[model samples]
Target: MVATTAPPPVERVAPQPPWAAGLSDVTASDASLRRFLHGLPGVDQVGAEARATMLATRSIKTVAKAWAIDLAITMIDLTTLEGQDTPGKVRALCAKAMRPDPSDPTVPRVAAVCVYPDMVPMAVQTLSGSGVRVASVATAFPSGRASLAVKLADTRDAVTAGADEIDMVIDRGAFLSGRYMQVHEEIVAVREACGNAHLKVILETGELVTYDNARRASWLAMLAGGDFIKTSTGKISPAATLPVTLVMLEAVRDFRDTTGRQVGVKPAGGIRTAKDAIKHLVLVNETAGDDWLDPDWFRIGASSLLNDLLMQRTKMATGRYSGPDYFTLD
Candidate 1:
């Protein structure tokens, strides 16, 4: 009888991270994009708006309120995106991110200091070893009308300058014109250009014209490998409304259900008061579930929201209104 030998055992392949699974298949062609995106469930404006309004009424008093305030501070992307964004301004913002309130060491620091790509190095230098991250906005920013080459170069420069996170704007014109594949390709290219840095794709919801469109854009960005889906650039009006944010939260929730990926959601612009920030937290808690309550999975993109959160936190601690005078403006 001939001796029989068992074949060598096959090596088991490790599973891809939930976020990366099925991405290659979806991005293969324009037909696939249309089939996937158009197949997503549509958003109901009235229902989403009503849900946000109801959540806005959630009341958190005393200890719970204070906890929410601190959490909001940690979720802030302390932003300063003006043409006059000087190195001095960037350093000042970095200082605030490091020490939100010099008077009280108990107060938590902001999440990151967001600045133009040119000022990323200054932010990185100032925030070094302090636990605060440096985030830069690239890809032609608020208006993504530039060529893909220019956008990729802009993103690479920020990454080379040590930006910990890259906030890139999608080509709104392409998305609006039914060019879903073009937008997806751009996001994929930018995600590649970002290398190891986290990528946040801005939908600029204000320009999308409808909740359905915003939902579509949100899904498109996530499918293209965006770590976070941002609502706006804060340069336009009607930025970061409650209803729009609710729609985004819903999209992310469904995405997680479908892909087992917990992508982040950022509602940028127009959220100035602590009350507004808390409302957003409630929306996140109730809608996306508490799994996304942490800073790693949620962010508030604002320049002034930090001060408001500080004032409220002080009020909760000491029985008096701290006012804007207490917190330094960066």
Candidate 2:
């Protein structure tokens, strides 16, 4: 019988980077974040309780009015649509809503005007006195396929053109391929390129393919210094789902728990109806609490959602259905 050679000892792969390992530590100590989230009674569990405990019951009209006010107060970030090309039009549209009615303190200002990097200057110039921020989708947006130099240049150019926020798409391919370090490094470099502007790292959840990956990406982005972790670019087929949002919120909660850093979350794409918006609001209320409800920590990236909300509000107030054209393009 031939003697069998002894198998060579297997080499052990090293643990993940410091940032990745530290995610758990950071997420554990954020008691305030946990307290706020846990304290908010979930509508699913306490809807009846809420209805019974209200100081006074609200009529349908009152509920409609309240929804109108909520819609008006909502921070809507309009991502681009295929037919809408000019930044001027986007600016005009945002400007009309920027002028908050002094008579109605209930009406909150529009959040910000988001656009392609080339249009940042136009949006910034148009929204100069309007108090609306100019957000640019940079760093090989919707497809983090470019070289590091190109991504940095893209981010720097957007900032130089007056972008208040840079929404960068992470390298999903690398992340999926088990190259977490590559993803982490890319996000850090882009964050550095952002300068003082806020960085929204898009994980494109639909493409991530699993809740575990979504959670991992969320932690990775936060650890890599992302100011916000956004879901979807709205360019893909399957965009923003409730389950995905749940995973992300958990990640945010966990991140804050450990690092004491407050990271924002934005759910973009396929969020069209008022009921859908309310569901997201409910999620925020339950998962992240009152603190994250504001535009500072949360936002809805939509194109036609505002118009539908506005139309519904007008109908509820006037008791008549308004035509689609009721909302002017500008």
TM-score of each: 0.92, 0.78
lDDT of each candidate versus the true structure? 0.88, 0.71
- lDDT by residue for model 1 (1-330), tens: 001221333332444444434755876888877776776667877889899999898777776787788899999999999998899988888998999999999989988889999999899999999998989999999798899999999999999999999999999999999899999999999999999999999999999999989988998999889999999999988899999999999888877766777899999999999999999998887777777888999999998888888888888888998888778976
In order of listing, the candidates' clash counts read 0, 8
Model 1 stretches astray by more than 4 angstroms: 1-24
* Residue pairs of candidate 1 with colliding backbone atoms: none
TM-score of predicted structure 1? 0.92
Locate the minimum summed-lDDT window of 10 residues in model 2.
Answer: 1-10
Find the candidate with the highest lDDT and give its number. 1
Which parts of model 2 have CA positions greater than 4 angstroms off?
Answer: 1-73, 81-84, 96-107
Highest TM-score scorer:
1
lDDT of 1: 0.88
